[model samples]
Target: MSKDFYTQFILPYAGIIIKICRAYTDSEEDFQDYYQEVCLQLWKSRENFKGDSKWSTWVYRISLNVSLSLLKKDKKVNKKSVELPNLDAGAPQDPNPFNDESLKLLYLAIKELSELDRAIILLYLEENSYQEIAEIMGLSPNNIGVKITRIKKKLKTLLDGKIY
Candidate 1:
């Protein structure tokens, strides 16, 4: 991919990277650091990107790979607890942004989900088509659709406090 292609096509999706990082990290700093790492890894892998896939699909592949690899490293280093250093010990928590408390709760519930579920949720939440999500995740489009359906129900239940 050319630099302009990266900037134009890939940069606008940076929020998705932030969401992925936040899903993987418990603390804000670690989230930022991991997001930066994902950006670097994505840039490094630019040449490996082929035109067979959408840019978003390519980014999803790269970001998920980096996040999962980092998660594995984290597991190896901190087997019991994944606590990050406390940088904002006294900072007040910010209110969730979505007007729909359910949506906000959904994002909170997403953080509790496994890494695989997080990727599914991230793409679905971004309004990616089932085919695009399937392409990025290497799942059949039908399977991706079903999983997304199940996950959405799971999110609603969690948001409604039907299940913790």
Candidate 2:
């Protein structure tokens, strides 16, 4: 990609990249680290981008791979005393009248979902269609729909009736 192309096409999607990183890491410092790592990966992979896929698709794939690796590192650091399920799973319910505090609670809830589910829910909420989501997730659109329904039910249970 040309420098101008990098500046225009790629940089604009930084927000999406950051959101994915934030969803994976709770702390600002951790978010920054992961965010940088994802960016670096994107730049490294940019030359390989054949324009066969959307730039967003290529970047999303790289970012997801980076996030999953970081997650594995986290697990190793913590050790498997009690298996830590996905954060979006086993997360507390959302408090009523959502505010900053409640929003944090919601993210905590989101973190409970599996990484793939997290990607689905995020892309869904961001208005990506099942077809697009399936593309990012390497699943069929039918499978994406089924997984999303299950994810919604799980999120509802976790967020229902919980105070922030």
Candidate 3:
């Protein structure tokens, strides 16, 4: 992507991209790799964007797709579970926005979800309307509602220690 485009569009949406990368990755290194890959993919796919939806929505779609592809590739090669770092057991405090312990655990729980469920919950967390999520995910609006309910229940179970 051009510097102007990155500054004007992608940089503004970098927070969303980082959140998606963090949700899918298990380590700081992996997170950085995923974030870089997402940016590269977004730049490469810019021509495919038809303005059918909002720019942020398109960025979300690209970020999730790139993350999922990397995740699947890693699983096929390693077949080993990668533990995410416990931010609660950190070395020092800083001004990082994603440093809350509760939010860390929440993301850990989200990591346990199925790929599609993870995407759904992330979009929900972003405050996307059901219709908008449906459009981005290519699901019916009613289906998005039903899935969100189920995903919430699953997340609650995960948080409650009933399931992980």
Candidate 4:
């Protein structure tokens, strides 16, 4: 792929890509694989984009699809544990929400959700409007709202009702 495409398209959306990939993968190695695959898919599908949706929406759909696909593939193979470097190890201390213990617990709870539910909750946490989520997820706006409510309840239960 051209450096120009990487700089112009992927760079701006790196955060979205990272968050989607991280939410889907359990370990650093898997995370790296998923991220690279999503980028490759984005590059390959660029020519097929037909002005049907906002560019960010396209990114979200592609990222989610790639993550889900890779996750299923990984499950088919027997996985071995690999220790990874601390993700926050050389980073400056900031008030990032991921640094919060409660948020960590929330993420743990999220992992217990079904794959489709994980995508819905991830998009919801990103503050995507119900309609936008519906558009990206190929669901009705009302269905998105209902799913979000159920996912929240599931998270609350998974967290023992401590950090809803």
- Winner of 2 and 4 under lDDT: 4
- The C-alpha local distance difference test score for the whole of candidate 3 amounts to 0.82
- Measured by TM-score, how close is model 3 to the native structure? 0.87
- Alpha-carbon runs more than 4 Å astray in model 1: 1-10, 79-103, 161-164
Tens digits of per-residue lDDT for model 4, 11-105: 88877887787677777677777878888999999999998998899999999999988888887885634443145532222236377678778
Instruction: Write the residue-wise lDDT of candidate 1 on 121-158 in tens digits.
Output: 88888889888888889899999989988888877767
Ranking by TM-score: 4, 3, 2, 1
Q: TM-score of predicted model 2?
A: 0.79
Model 4 Cα displacement at 159 (Å)?
1.6
Q: Looking at model 4, report the run of 10 residues with the lowest lDDT sum.
A: 85-94
Better candidate by TM-score, 2 or 3: 3
* Residues 34-88, model 3: lDDT tens digits: 8788888889998899998899999999998999999999888984447764334
Of models 2 and 3, which has the larger lDDT? 3
Error of 3 at 79 (Å): 6.1
Cα lDDT for residue 120, candidate 4: 95
Could you tell me every candidate's TM-score relative to the true structure? 0.77, 0.79, 0.87, 0.88
Error of 1 at 78 (Å): 2.0
Deviation of model 1 at 129, angstroms: 0.9
lDDT of each residue in 46-138, candidate 2, tens digit only: 678898768787777887889879878977897323222222321122233134666666678988898888888877876878888888889
Off by over 4 Å in 3: 79-95, 161-164
TM-score preference between candidates 1 and 2, better one: 2
